[model samples]
Target: MSQKILMVDDEADLSKLVAHHLQKEGFEPLCVSNGSDALKALAKQPFSLVILDIMMPGEDGLQVCRKLRNKEETASIPILFLTAKDEESDKVVGLELGADDYVTKPFSPKELMARVKALLRRTERKESASSYAYRDLVMDVPRHEVSASENRVTLTAKEFALLEHLLKNKGKVLTRDHLLNTVWGYDYFGTTRTVDVHVRRLREKIPLLTDAIETVPSLGYKLVDEE
Candidate 1:
């Protein structure tokens, strides 16, 4: 079945345009003009991803994001924020609150669609070998599950892929470019910060990797063996 996406934006024209494009891309897009309705719709339905506008009446995007993250049932759903505010702080705030991506205002429909596709692609469960493990951290590839010791660790699709790549490489430092190419695909137009965001999420989810994933100054990152 085609994935369903929820787009919450006060701009009726923009929502229409995005919904049209998403339809053409074989997705079912549901548009809500306010944060209240968006939350209501989310509660009623299961959406694969949410395209949220940062500025809205009543509960704004950041408020909505925080609520979503707090909800156990809705927390893992991916979110992409649409914002006219291009400030780095705005983007950082959204990312820190669990937004999967952000697109500035006046963005090309094509580019937005690309981001949508890449984000959704990450949600697909990867079917591969049995598992990949580094000590107590284990990723069951076919099952799309990750666990530290015996406790499960919840990771987004992007985080899962990033951790998998790091586990596969082990000790080698991977450049951000290489990680972006390998994990997000070559056509992904996002910056290296996207990699950093997912990596941070990974570390937060798997506390055992607090120091395992090292940041190389003036370079990229490496997943090292636990001493």
Candidate 2:
């Protein structure tokens, strides 16, 4: 079966164009004009990915992205933001809000399609192991669940990916650029700061990791066994 992708954008012409491209790539596309309708569509069915526009009438893309990340049913679905704003800060905000990728307006169809495929590939990729643990913090890869000190921890999809990478390569110094390429994909448009933000979040969310993730001055981070 073709994977279903939800495209939420206020621009009617753009939606049609994107839908056409998605269909050509063997993806089933569903277009909606606003956040409310996007949410409604999501409630009715599961989608493999979401292409969201940042600017809209009400409950803009950021709001909608937040809502989706908060829901267990929709949290892991990849979200790619389509926006006219090319500002760095705008892109950062979208990523911080749990968007998997961002594409500025005036984008080429080739570039957009590449971004879509990258996200889908990342989401669909499977881990070799079922779980990873460090002290009291444990990540159940198959279940898409995490716990710190036996307490369930809520993490966005990106956060989970970032942490998994760190755990998989424990004791190795991983640079921010490497993390971005591995976890966020080489197609990611943002800066290394994106890696920093997500790493900070992981440390914050998993208290045991506070001192565990050693920050190598001017280098990157290394996950070491807590002494």
Q: TM-score for every candidate vs. truth?
A: 0.90, 0.93
Deviation in angstroms for 89 in model 2? Answer: 1.1
Give all candidate RMSDs, comma-separated.
2.0, 1.6
Question: Model 1's lDDT to the true fold?
Answer: 0.86
RMSD over all Cα atoms, model 1:
2.0
- Where is model 1 more than 4 Å wrong at Cα? none
Model 1, 142-188: lDDT tens digits are 87778898897766556777888898899999999999888878767
Q: Please, what are the lDDT tens digits per residue for candidate 2 over residues 134-212?
A: 8898899988899988998888778888889989998999998898899878886667888887787778878878889
Estimate the TM-score for candidate 2. 0.93
For model 1, what is the alpha-carbon lDDT of residue 151?
Answer: 94
Q: After superposition, how far is residue 11 of candidate 2 from its true place, in Å?
A: 0.4
lDDT of each: 0.86, 0.88
| Candidate achieving the largest lDDT | 2
